[model samples]
Target: MLCAVVLNAAQAASAQSVVVQPAVQVRSVTTNNVSFAEAEVARSDSVLIVTPRLDVLTVNPGYRLNASLAADAVTYLGRSQADRLLPRAQADLTAQLVERWLFVDGRLSADTTAGNPFGVLEDESSTIFNRTTVYRQRISPYVERELSPRERLQLRTDHSWFQNRNAGGTDTRIDTYLLSQRASYELRPQPLGLRAEYTRDSSDYSNLPDSSVLFETARLSAMYEAAPQLVLTLTAGSDHARYSGIDQRETLRGFGLRWEPSERTSVGALVEKRFFGTGWAVNLAHRAPFLVLNADMQRRSTTYAAQVAALPAGGDVAQLLDSLLSTRITNPVERATAVQQLIAQRGLPATLASALDLFSPSAQLLNSASLSAALLGVRHTITLRGFYDRTEDLIGVNPPPLFSSNARQYGASLGMTRRLQPDATADFSLTRSRVVGFGTNAGVVTNNLSVRFGASRQLSLRTTVSAALRRQWVDSTAVTNANQTALSFGLLHRF
Candidate 1:
């Protein structure tokens, strides 16, 4: 259905430009503690991983597509029964249906993740029994209209679905639908505006009927330009929510401010009163010649599926640095290479940052704060990131074991990189995290620590080689403590 929709929309567009990239990677891993065991057990293992991947990008006046797909084949030396194949993919499409008036956005993704937050964390090449594959898709179509020079309107509808493949009877399926309408009018010279918006969101579950939820909201906002670079907003709204066969209503009032003193800095904040209590959000970003920083904080009612879908495509550090480098680098290939080199030197993931997702089928009151900063010197690079979060299940106490009831998690990571030569780089990183659960799982706590050292060299224009040594330790009240050390060598080639 998604392919058909995109093809039909593309028929009305002009000529299209497309690019395809294919790559292969091989890695050899050796570990003394294959199962992250305690008691100084010497269970050694050797593993081999082969991966083939493809990326596609297409652009036209009326449509665009971006996709990445990969398959990883893992072999456990002398343990054929433990070998496995893993698949991963992410794709997104945007099409303009009626010039600039109608448009559609679609996304699809599949990956494997831990089903339980307290489960042991292991590398992708090493399989764990508590992992599950997740599939998600979403489509949204909207209409944008300029009623007049100072008036505008937008109407949109979204449909999303999420599914889990698990043998533990936690196989869940969810369908979500949303409808929204917004209109605004502004007095140009007066620098004042009034906007009204309405939204209705509904979710259905296949195995958890009682967890279904529906929300309806209507709001009116007034904005005033306090200064040339500052804006203030006041909003009043009402919310109606239905969950667990219960209906509830709440009054909403919010105040917001946006400050953009310069092109390199931006700050925005919002504070509101809602059903559970006060909800707040803050965002700050600043970019300098050799430094990039971003921070945000928010508290809201959300589901795990929604959060998963909103993850950044290229990771936190990579995305921010990419945006900052865009103005300095013009060629696409050069910019991408620069981004990769920066990530490799800093010991950062090219994808999303690591986190312990407290997966839940029902709604949760989530409060989270995160900060990331990077400094680039002539031959040295330093990166730091920190995050804190608290989650409370909205469905009530005594929930299923797979669902998170109440939990607090906090973590931080610091990395340093140095250029050994023109084509060689080395890096070191340390990460720490702690998780504590309340309510039914009261007194359960887990602490994790990781240290790694890595070095990489560019073998040729299309090939690169790298080696890394990592040590991981885990101390938990819910499970036995563990210590593991792994050494790996990898080669990647592109075509």
Candidate 2:
């Protein structure tokens, strides 16, 4: 359905001149796993997956469009119940409906993944890597109008849905929606600005009615530019929520400052007070010739669906920097080399070079802090990062036997990546996490180590062969001791 929609939109835009690109891939994978239970009673499986992808881009003076679609067909060698096809699609559109006065933006995406391991797309380290698949869809639309030269108005809405089947042979569904509007105006035309905004969020769960929530918030803010490198902001707000037929209201106020004294350094801080508690946040970042640093701390109240919605929408900063560097080089191999050289020259930290996939979303209010640093070398890179989080009223199992309790989590990771040759690269990482204060799974520890070596060589004008081996280990109270290993080889021909 999503592919059809994207194709139709592309066809319509092609009438006015649009660009389209397509790609295809075929891969074979074999894996052995000893999951949960005793190590002696593990399971192994072999599978093959084939994928085809398409990308379309349309651009003009007043409008732009980008869309991509990929379909994956999986076949199990001896397990007929674990074979299925999945489709992933994404689309983004922006248009200037009425010159510079009015604009529109929209995005749509759909994905399918295994429910265990928190539906992570590429990793299989969960205790129960079941065959059941979960499907998720998201849509966002936004509009903005220029009320005046120094004033603007905007409106945005988001809708997301999740569907899956549980072990009890029942279907589960979750729906979430968000609506917001904002108006901003310059107060004195000299670094003074004022803004007002309103936001509403709603979440509904088919199997967990008591967990549903509806919340509304309104805020007014004032900003002053103290100097060329400093700015201050103050905000006052109120929140009203309805949960399980109970209504509650709270007052909120906050102060913030942003300072950037140099080209390579920046600092930000915010302190807020609310009826339920006081929250504070801080961020510091610096880039040097040989090192990069980033640190942050935050305290906030959020629900499960809201947290999921707040996940990063784009790739990490490292990937963004690589893309920017790629535009300067025409050759694909040279672009990769230039990106690595630029990363080393700019002292891009190790923590920012790779995505932080350790954190897990929980349906609880929490306070968290993290620090990451990266050291770039001539031919190698090293990174270190740590995080700590404390959750309030953590939700556990069901409500019958009461398995919910508060918990604290902390973790650290160390990683290194090296260029073995012009066409070969190697990466290694080790991570450890611990959870405490939970009811049954108190003092649970998980450790994972992964290493991969990849090389590519052209066989013909449009063909290449690549191979890799991956090993992972998971140790936890829930999963006991489990080990997984996989070796894969693929042949690709692009046109």
TM-score (all chains, Cα) for each model: 0.89, 0.74
Prediction 1 global C-alpha lDDT: 0.72
Encode model 2's per-residue lDDT on 13-47: one tens digit a residue: 64544656565666666667523234676566666
Instruction: Please list all clashing residue pairs in model 2, or write none if there are none.
Output: 349-374, 350-374
Pick the TM-score winner: 1
Regions more than 4 Å wrong, model 1: 1-5, 8-14, 40-42, 123-130, 146-149, 166-189, 313-315, 330-347, 352-354, 396-402
Candidate 1 lDDT over residue span 138-188, tens digit each: 888888877778777788877777676542224554444333333334433
Residue 3 displacement in candidate 2 (angstroms): 17
Q: How much lDDT does each candidate structure score?
A: 0.72, 0.56
